[model samples]
Target: MSMGTKQAALDGVGRCSRSRPQRQSGVALLATLILVLALTLILGNIFYRHQIDVSQATGSLHGDQAMLLAISAESWARDLLASDNDDPEVDHFGEDWAQAIPLLPVDGGTIVGCLVDLESRVNINNFSSYTDTSLRAERSANANNMGLVKLWENLLQNMGFVVDESRVSVIVDWLDKGDELIGPAGAEQSDYSGFNPPRFPANTYIADTAELAAMAGYSLAEVQRLMPLMSALPGPTTININSAPEPVLMALSGDLGIDFVDMVLDNRPFLTLQEFYQAIDIRLMVGEPALAIRWPAKLIDVKSDFFQLNLEVTLGQSRLEVKSIMQRGESGRPAVIRREITVVPAGVTTVPSRSIDTDDENAADFSGSGRDRFSDPDEYDREYYLRPICEIADSYTTGDLDDSGEQF
Candidate 1:
């Protein structure tokens, strides 16, 4: 072979080797870019999850702090009510404890709340007397036993609900410790089983007004509407005429017309039951004498024993609401009978200023634990024989009429 031809072949082989190396370098560069992209995506996902976990943990911590603040506020309320017992014979909106706890800045946020007189509203548990079969039969035989039932009927009418005796019967059946129906509208486990997701009747005194709405013939809206005027106290309690809403005062007796209610409302914060009676004597005299005679004197008083403390605590990102029921006996020291707490959502605001709501039992989140002290009121020897101030004046002692130990 010629030397020139051999040199040409060697040059061609060198060019081919150089081109192969360039192609391999390009592939390696692409692979390195792909690896970096995959790692970046993985790290980004991890960082995002960590941020979410941190946020959730922070929220939980804030909620715990808010709850503690709310509990502390509850203790403060108990003491306030205890001190107010110096004049336990009278509890009215004009009193110090009735005033609201204004929004006060705390460590992390703010706290606000107010006290409610539970006695100012009708107690649904008053009808639990129907649970006793013998008593039920006896009450059924007497028109006087039907006084509370009639009052409830009137309240329903005032609240725009259709007045049905069955409505009251159903509520009684829910509270009665019997499987037998109280009336045509009464409900039992059998009736409850017909629901989509079956529910059973409580068959005992309810701790929450939500239970009242759960019964047949009652709606959530109706219960909410009545929330301002009704309570599910541990037992039967008299209405505090001093603080009762106009609707409640009107419900006390069918004869208590709006004009009569106005008289009670305008001159109220009555210092004594006698004072309340005097304020309405003029109207009572003018009304039908028979109806005036039946003025439900037994169902009312000027003082109260049951009160509710509603507190709202806000800490950082968390807002908590608490409701506590307190029972103040003759000793005058208030004891918590029930408590409930709820976590409110962000971006929602409730009236921070204090206002009166009949009972906290109306809240859907009624998860509280406490023992209730209950004493059934004495049954009247004569059902409709309720008397006013003049009749009781001769027998009424100065302190005998205090609500803590009141007989009627």
Candidate 2:
């Protein structure tokens, strides 16, 4: 009776053990499937994000490539200038000043270039020195306030100050004199009473062309009118006649005639003293033989062996710009002396406005197409050179107040 009862209990115990083990194995398989699915979903999300980042990175790289191409166009144009020897006007593939350089594989937009006379605008940086008769006369007999510089002087002069006593001279004095000293009875920190960047000698030249608006005599309206036509560059006081407009050429004269203005305008430039003098002698009047003109060119405004090129580019989501300035060096007649690149916010620029005269009063303003985006060297102030110099002028110091090296 004891043996039979023990056998039945042992069989029941074995069955219970086998069933428990099978249920545990099934639960383990379910957990494994869920774990695998979770890992697959996590990996898919990571892969999707990685693809987005890669796409963004590729687009950015393309934009950089486009910007580089835009910069290359500028270099190519500068090289053309260096090789030109004596030819002016950029004798291009076409007669247009802003000749398109053509879009290529990496380039995102069209690029074009033009040369403007560095000397055409009044050198606002020298306002202090121009005021100083003793200082300015040494530069040239023609150095007396005239042309675009005189236009500005006349503007201020018309407002109040005596021609010689005008604030323009004070500004000239500040720029021309390396030593920061207010002339006798002139404005200086000692005379400023309490102003910053004193009206009198501040012992420094202008660091920024925008600083001119802060000077005592200039009105915002007047400055705005005159500013577009002038610059504060290393070259003070002189605007390159070769690069000047007909309006500037007419203003340069003490007394001007229609024929004279036309004559000067007909010609592209008069940089060399002989070239200017000759151009003047050849009278535009019908009755006059090539008689001598009244004024002699005393000063020469040079663009120097340097130039600045503006480049803008867009590629995919990347957008950039470059303010590149290049220098002529010791290697040869016009070898590359230095090169600098300045990047600024995209879409910001100082593009010039344009207008065209017509017999019809109702003429449309179709000249939007005529706007010039390339900033003429004259459009800058002498102080404007500091930025390029800071970036490009090696063997020089940011400490310099004026750049006499590029004087015209």
Candidate 3:
């Protein structure tokens, strides 16, 4: 070996040492990158969970606010109805209480509500008072039953639904407190046994009109079509002629054609039952004898006892809908009989401007024209507060107010 060979060996050793450090540095960099990735994943998961919790808390807060606002609106409606005792004999669209609560902005979002006369629609529960079976039997024997049956038939035909008298019989059997079938067309427990989920007829008043879909021979679609014109009140309720829709007015008698309904609506807000009868005679050119045979006075009235308040409240991302039924008596404050609250998707709604188009030939159309009676929000809000003291005084007799110390 010579000196040149030794030098070559030294160079090889240097190259080896340099390559070892480069490999180690590469491994260390890989480890550091792996550690960073792991920390990032863990932190991301924690942040995501925190975000979800915050969203849930915010939603809950909004929901609570919406509920409270709905309750306040319901109280307002009850008070409005109670204060309407000044003209307790009539409930017309022209009345202050009948006005819709025009959209009003609130602290967090907005709220809108309206009062509807439930008596304007036919009451399916009117068939049976949900009392003793004997009373139901007695009512069935009365002229009102026949009149109601006729009205139901007329309404179905007008709405383009298949008129099946058997369906009416089934409803009758369902409402009656008796186990006996109404007729061969009626459904009893035996008829319902074949249903997908076997059930029996609720032999009592229905809390909601949706129950009508469960009856035999009726479909959900048919019930939906009839829902706008019908109600399932707690007991027998007369149809309010002052606020009844044109369809209901047309259903009142076979003799009442579209022209007659238009005339009746044109001369609206009948002050008394006698005034309504007089309008009928004047429009039909027929005497009370013909009217008596077709229409039953007991089944109709100018006043309403049951009113429904439909309110919508919004708070942040939450939207809530509330419906409350109030029963107004001849005296004292109106009481809330039923209440329903639901959470819906968040969104905004636009309230259409209301104006009575009297120049239009169809101005007497009840559905559209009647809605036009609601004034602006400012006007609607001021109505209750600005009511005359004399009107409040009229709510009670002088002797009663003197004794109760409730006089204004």
* Per-model TM against the reference: 0.74, 0.55, 0.74
- Decide which is better by lDDT, 1 or 2: 1
For candidate 3, list the clashing residue pairs, or say none: none
Q: What lDDT does model 3 reach?
A: 0.70
Model 2 agreement with the true structure over 173-198: per-residue lDDT tens digits = 44554544435424444434354433
Candidate 1 lDDT trough over 10 residues, lowest sum: 367-376
Per-candidate clashes come to: 0, 32, 0
Deviation from native of the Cα of residue 64 in model 1, angstroms: 1.2
lDDT of 3 at 282: 83
- Give the residue spans of candidate 3 off by over 4 A: 1-21, 84-86, 129-146, 283-294, 346-408
Q: Which residue pairs does candidate 1 place in steric collision?
A: none
The residue-level lDDT of candidate 2 at 287 comes to 23
The residue-by-residue lDDT of candidate 3 on 42-155, one tens digit each, is 999999999999999999999998898888888877777775443677888888787778788998799977787889888998766433344345346644333676788777
RMSD of each: 12.6, 12.1, 13.4
Q: lDDT per residue, candidate 1, 300-320, as tens digits?
A: 778888988878788888998
Ordered from best to worst lDDT, the candidate numbers read 3, 1, 2
